[model samples]
Target: MVKVSFSSALAQKEVKKDAESLLPGEKDPEVGVPLRQPSRAWCWCMCLGLALMLSGVVVGGAYLYRYYIVEEGRVFVCGVKYREEDYIIREEEEVQLPSHFQLRKLEESIRILEREQVALINVPVPEFQDSDPADIVHDFHRRLTAYLDLSLNKCYVIPLNTSVVMLPTDLVQLLDNIRMGTYLPQSYLIHEEMVVTEQLQHVEQLGYFIHSLCQGKDTYRLQRRDRILGMQKREALNCHKIRHFESNVVVETLICEP
Candidate 1:
């Protein structure tokens, strides 16, 4: 009986030990969660890394767009100087004076009559000035007459008076004037008339005509016309003339009728 009792006690002890092992004690502090499950800390780190990579991509794209686009095709104006000999044709006149004196007049003319013509249209003429107005005017008339005598017939000349011209004080008042409003069309018509009358042969003759017009009193009209047109367009037409430096040529540009 003693042997049987000892054996029974030993079996009971083994069962108790097996139950304790299966139930598992308070969970291990070090391995509280399963190793297969992702940790919240690791998930947050992954999200932060993805966010950084995305931001980098966006920033790089913006930089490339700015560098490759939006900075081309700009117009710049530069000034150049030319000499008298560059003109296609030049003429001289001799004047006989008292006491066996003689004066040689240099007449510089462009080759508007040639087949290769350069066109000048509606160029603004600057105002002229005279320290002694009467003497200058007389001299202008004499030179003009002499020019007309040549009968070149390839250009029309409009003389300007520099000494008497001024910019308009009130822009509105200036616009009301008929002379300034129709200057361009009138000039165009004048050119056309000259062409029709056989006074100007080639379109290029217009350049010479513009140069001549800019020489004296008529430039004021051109400038006034340009200013009026600029105001109407809401742009500054302050630069009234366009010049081709190599050719000693000037023309009208940037003025548009409203």
Candidate 2:
């Protein structure tokens, strides 16, 4: 009304509005919105999780390397000293030590042996008639030789016949004897003995028979002639008790009590 300019009046209204907005009791433009800060708990948890994952990977890698990469490639050569106790009947003798080679090499040797028709047999004592022990042993050797010759074409057979006589008691004595140097060069003797002893126990059961002896019968007695006849029949019927086989030449020991 006092000749004031319109532009000046508009500017004054805008300033008044801005002042009102900044007043203490006025609503702020950003009211009711929460500000987010980085969480310390979440950061710590993520770091711990990553550390645990890294530790597990390291342990698993070590185990794999030890078992597969290192151990599987290693070769162990054992010196087998055959003691008299090693055989149930024969005296002590030393068998040649096996050539030391990696698992792959040994496997290759075995495959070669098979391809060349090698005869590898695990001999178990067959039940014999009422004859001398020496005769039984001799007969076994003869039969084995013939069987092996017939079975293989071009071959090298390792005779483990001495292993047939190994008894549980003999095994205990062997360990002690080897440790005490009853045999010379006690370096790897004990270790070899233990391996062989364990291996022998894994073979088939020993052969034996039960014979019943009866004294003077009074009334119900079968004559000696009849008894002898019956025995012959039984023997003839059970003659096929012995078991044998042939294949690519691998003998796995089966564990059982004697």
Candidate 3:
């Protein structure tokens, strides 16, 4: 509802001039061509242009998101200046590990094993009279089994002398008892106790069996074949004697792939 105004002087002047021009009775020249309805094609072209512009914006935004925003972290890392001694791994190489290194590693390994052996041997008798001494035996059996299994399967070579062996069925069953966290039948347990006074003797035999497998070899090398060497955590004493153990039995064995 805006009111448009024309200049008063210009309007008056134009009216006077027109009046003077029209006195001769000459018809006024045609003012202008009348406009017709716009063609449908023009409307279609405008819509098409708008659609194209919208599509271009969407595509550009996606490109910016992926290569600029998403990849910004990797780009920043690549642009960083690094020191020469930063251990940038560009290529793979096989470096022969030194004998001294092997010695040091084995010494550390043996120290840990010895500590574990001592811990197993000196298991404090449970304060409760109902507790079983055979639990100590179970714990030792598990460790020895791990050691044997590593020697048998994993090539975890140590500086200590060892002998390779194909384990007998009886020994295998005993090892399984440790893995399954199971006990032998009462008759079998009684028979074994009668045969050997100390469960520690069984451990010694297992160790001897493992030692014999080394065939007097002084040095052995372990090449990692698997992505993981496996994990090592001691199992808590199994009082439940549940046949179906809740989790996968984790055994810490000498470095050998079984």
Candidate 4:
């Protein structure tokens, strides 16, 4: 590097020249100049634009929220109306049977006999799902009155339709009369089938007998088909039938998927 010393007179002349060359309001560059400030009108304009964008977002969000609420309300109302109409139609078309309690009392009358060597009362309960294990039970005495479900390891009594199935005493007496030749007993075969339908709610109200039959399962309805034709035809998909001779009557209870 090169170093040179300036005389006092030369340094004073250079400072005077720089002062004379400066404009009235301009600051000297050696001391650093401040940047130009933005106008008040430009700052206000930017703030207004941001506020308008935020307001639009709030209004759009509210509109979407209200739209979804209205749509959901409409769907719920329509579903309720449809269910009401369906209930009315069903009531008119079908004859209501006695309540589950009445049926349970009748089932309780029949005794639960001891298990036989070979289990025969293997029947599926309602709402049979794909994942459920193989549940089989035996109707040992050929009475076809009660069964045990191996899945739950519980015994359930089936209510006999008095209008259809004769009482145990009457059934035994009929067999004796046939043997005595009191009258020519015309024997005919009948087919009875059961299928899983809707879920059975309020199982507690059905009493112990019915509760065991319908417990952990859906409601099953008997589907009566022509004896001759249905016996020959194949059963439906996921359908299982259990046939047993109860002295005088041949009973077949079919359980199927819902």
Clash count, predicted structure 3: 17
Candidate 2 lDDT, 32-144, residue by residue in tens: 86889989999999999999999999999998875455323211121222221222222375644345521110011000111112222223332332111110111122222
> For each candidate, what TM-score against the reference?
0.19, 0.23, 0.21, 0.30
Per-residue CA lDDT of model 3 for 1-258, tens digit only, reads 999999999999999998988797664577555679999999999999999999999999998975455423210000111111212222364434334431100000110122122111111223333222211111232233212222122111222211211122333334344444333221100000001011121223334333333333322333222222342223232221101000111111223222
Question: Model 4: residues >4 Å from true position, as ranges?
Answer: 1-160, 172-189, 212-236
For candidate 2, give the lDDT of residue 192: 14
Query: Which candidate should be chosen as best, given TM-score against the real structure?
Result: 4
What overall lDDT, based on C-alpha atoms, would model 3 receive against the true structure? 0.29
Model 1, 149-213: lDDT tens digits are 11122222333322321122221123234233322111100000011111322323334334443
> Cα deviation of 2 in candidate 3 (Å)?
71
lDDT per model vs. reference? 0.28, 0.28, 0.29, 0.40
All models, RMSD in angstroms: 22.1, 20.1, 27.2, 22.6
Worst 10 residues of 3 by lDDT: 188-197
| Candidate 1 CA-lDDT value | 0.28
Lowest lDDT sum, 10 consecutive residues, model 1, at: 186-195
Best by lDDT: 4
User: Which residue window of length 10 is worst by lDDT in model 2?
Assistant: 208-217
